[model samples]
Target: MAFSSGSTGGPMANINVTPLVDVMLVLLIIFMMTAPMMSYPIDIDLPQRSLNPPQNLKDPPPPISLRIDASGQVYWNNSPTPISALRNMMETEVQRDVNNQPTLEIDVNEDADYGLLAKVLASAKNAQMQKIGFVKK
Candidate 1:
């Protein structure tokens, strides 16, 4: 509480915020002291370096090649395979290695039809083949 003192005015009521400010500062200090202690350090066992050479895991299989000639003819593994067989072939290849999916490399001729290339990509995706890359001649 505060009062106004003047030559010709009555006493005026005013709120003293000093106590509120002190309480807020105390609460801030309490939070700052306790915030750090609230967190606990986690224990972890990290991997150690070994002197022996690392053993080779499963060898990566050869990438399956799909070639599209200028005339829009599609070839699977250098052999003529129709567009209809692409999905089935891709599915079988994926099933062969369930753990590591085989990579499919599409080699498209410079003059190959865009529609044909799109169809090939769609077929590979439909078969759930994840690793598909383009092979530039």
Candidate 2:
């Protein structure tokens, strides 16, 4: 005599919620697993300096560049100079700058003899050039 709602065959209504609950739980677990790996902690208190940067940051022109080639030959500022003469010249330069010491930059090629490079460095020292450095190229 009377009609009811959501009851297809009888007087009972049922809904299947297992699939929807499974999907929601799977998504929650995925997010939980990935949240910890997303970001890492970096602990450091970096110091800040108020000093002005130098004008020639890349490379500064040294007083002299002593180059030793593969053939056991040396050049003083792109000119041929014997080790003895180079030593003497450096000695003279050092003497001229009595108050402040001048620096020498030695540039040795990869194929250059190691012994020759050592000798050149020694000569620079003997000439009183204390601030000596090697060039990468």
Candidate 3:
């Protein structure tokens, strides 16, 4: 706090901010000194290499293309496939290893039956197919 150097000295209307700025700078310095100590990263213990590594790590199987036409007819890889066979196909595909489960890409026409689409999705889920996907076209 400071008063004006005038003939009739009184309380100053404006505040002195130098002390406030000094205090803020001291607080900033204290935080800067302590921030690194507060943020020590948690250590991660990794598993040692297994004696038997994975065998025959070939590429994953190719994706299967499924298309549903406006008339509710299903096509498996561009060939006409009955809806009843979807389950058997899905089950056989899911027999692959988890990482090798082929992606089922389904393309549904705009006017396709929603019931058929739901049935297909339900079948995939029932078979525990991990990588069923829908195509835009």
lDDT of 3 by residue, 25-103 (tens): 9999999999988997888666688999889787879999999999999999999989899999989888867667999
What is the RMSD of candidate 3?
9.1
Q: Which pairs, if any, clash in model 1?
A: none
Model 3, 11: alpha-carbon shift in Å? 57
Model 2: per-residue Cα lDDT over 1-137, one tens digit each: 33446547555444668899999999999999999999899996575885985554444335687888888888888999887687788878788754456668888989988888888778876776767788896
TM-score of each: 0.58, 0.52, 0.57
Candidate 1 lDDT, tens digit per residue, 1-137? 44667775767676778999999999999999999999999996676888995576587789999999999899999999999998999999989986678789999999989999999999988998888899887
Ranking by TM-score: 1, 3, 2
Distance from true location, Cα of 51 in model 1, Å: 20
Q: If both were scored by lDDT, which would come out higher, candidate 2 or candidate 3?
A: 3
lDDT minimum window of 10 residues, candidate 2: 53-62
Model 2, residue 134: distance off in Å is: 0.8
Q: Which stretches in model 2 have alpha-carbon errors above 4 Å?
A: 1-62
TM-score: model 3 vs. ground truth: 0.57
How displaced is residue 33 in candidate 3, in Å? 39
